[model samples]
Target: MNALTGVLRYLGNYAISSVWRLGYGARLFLLTLLYSGESFKRFQLVLKELYSIGVLSLVIIMVSGLFVGFVLGLQGYNTLEKYGSEQALGILVALSLVRELGPVVTALLFAGRAGTAITAEIGLMKATEQLSAMEMMAVEPVARVVAPRFWAGVISMPLLAALFSTMGVFGGYIVGVVLIGVDEGSFWSQMQSSVDFHEDILNGVIKSFVFAVAVTAIALLEGYDSKPTAEGVSRATTRTVVTSSLMVLFLDFILTSLMFTS
Candidate 1:
């Protein structure tokens, strides 16, 4: 009976802690939103962060997209060839990338690369008392620091996802038509006929945008709330990657269900 009571007490405390964290994260998100308008005045900062988060991330996004599409093309051709549907390779690759893999993989990569960087940078600022010093000077750190990075992540995500899909298509074409002798005309025509711009492509963009907000929010919040120490900064960076990845996957399911359900 005592062990049962202890187990119940532990579960209750865990639930309460989880709720408290959620509420606190929501509060930070709201505060960041409140100061986001200030980013307009600091346009150069936003541009710089855009370059950092978006431009710097391009190489990995493209390379990964290409290779992933290449593999899909190869595997897809093998499977479809067995079923006498090899000409549908283009549609297969296009729908796979645009509808699912593109946004999902890009966001995962973004979280690992840009998300961790955001957390580390902000946590380092906190460790050095930069945010506190800004407060002393009557400056809002959220406006000056967090807001630009947040908005940068938001703006960069969809673009990166698009590029990933485009590259994936190209890679698929190279493998399917150029190498495997699938009819180029059929590949392109079938893909064009099957992929709906509004439904498949637009919904993918929406998914990326939603993932952007969730990832950026978690990254910035973890940094801002981190303990002002090296260990704390490291932990926050790790947490940023883990939490953002999980959030991206979870949000992807919810968005996919809503987008596809009748």
Candidate 2:
């Protein structure tokens, strides 16, 4: 009987947590729309955060994108060369980079770099009562901290993903056309003919934007809810990464289904 009671309690808690997470998502969506409607002074914070996340993250993004493109070109050219579709290297590279790999990989990297940092910094602040102090100062912490981070993530993830895709495609072109003896016109022509702008690429970017929102929310919530202790802050940081990454992956599946299916 005791064991049965524990199982029931566990199931109840799981159900509650799931519903709580759903509500949290709905609230964040509403808050984001509200922030989008606010004054320029409020909206400008998005740009500031965007610079920090998107611009500051450029170096790593470039390195990852360039190498991925080069590798794709090498492999894709080899694979298609026997079939007389070496020109399709550009199309392969563009599809993989833009439609799937680029945004997802970039978001994973962003979660590690900016996402972890946001969680740790905010969690530490919460532990130290800095957030509380701001509240006492009549500063709405969400408006000042969470809002900027949220908007920043939403705006920057898509742009950075685009940058990664473009650079990766450029790298592929260099490898395929300049080095591998494929004609530039053939490469571009194949890519243009094979890739559709709306169905594949745009959907991926939109998904990445939603991913940005999820990661920001998980990280900020972890930080905001940290207990008043060093250990607690540390725990929150770890939880933030685990939770945010899981949410990104899960939502990617959900959003992909919703976007592609009837």
Candidate 3:
């Protein structure tokens, strides 16, 4: 009886805690929206953040995209060769990268790399009482700090995803046409014919944009709500990566279903 009672109490507390956190997240999101107007006024800060988040992330995204495409070309060539459809390798690689892997993988990488950095930076600011100092100075930290980072992330995600897809196509070309001796004409032609700009490409951009908002929001909110301590900031940074990755995967599935469902 005591165990059963304890179990029920624990579940109730867990449910309440989850609800409270959700409410906090929603409130933070609203505050971010309120401060978003100030982002343009701090355009230089936004540009700086864009360079930190987007330009610094380009090498990893490009290298990963290329390797993924090369592997896909090799694997697709093998699989299609079995069915005597090796010429379809281009379509296979392009569709895989643009429709699914491009945005999803790039967002995941961004979460691990940039999202954790954002969380840690904000968390450290809180730990050092910098945010409090800003408040004392009558400076809105949300406008000066969080809003620009948020907008920069939202702007960067789509461009990074597009670059990833483009590099993947190039890598696929190298592997399929140059290395494996697939017909170059069939490779480009089939890929061009099969990949719809509106359906596949546009949906991919939408997915990346949605993922950007989710990932950036989680990163900033975790830091904002963290305890003002070294351990707290460390924990928040870790949570940024784990939570952002999970949200990206979950949102990707929902967005893909909505966009692809007939």
Q: Give the clashing pairs for model 3.
A: none
Cα-lDDT of candidate 1: 0.95
Residue 223 of model 1 has an lDDT of: 94
**C-alpha TM-score for every candidate:** 0.96, 0.87, 0.98
Local accuracy by lDDT, each model: 0.95, 0.81, 0.93
lDDT of 2 by residue, 140-259 (tens): 677777778777777788888888898899999889888878989979998999888788788888878888877877777777666768898888888877887788778877877887
lDDT of 1 by residue, 1-262 (tens): 9999999999999999889988988888898899888887879989999999999999999999999999999999999999999999999999999999999999999999999999999999999999999999999999999999999999999999999999999999999999989999999999999999999999999999999999999999999989999999999999999999999999999999999887
Per-residue CA lDDT of candidate 3, range 158-195, in tens? 99999999999999899999998999999999999999
Which residue pairs collide in model 1, if any?
A: none
**Residue 100 error for model 2, in Å?**
0.6
Best of the two (1, 2) by TM-score: 1
lDDT of 3: 0.93
Model with the higher TM-score, candidate 2 or 3: 3
Could you arrange the candidates by lDDT from highest to lowest? 1, 3, 2
User: Which candidate model has the greater TM-score, 1 or 3?
Assistant: 3
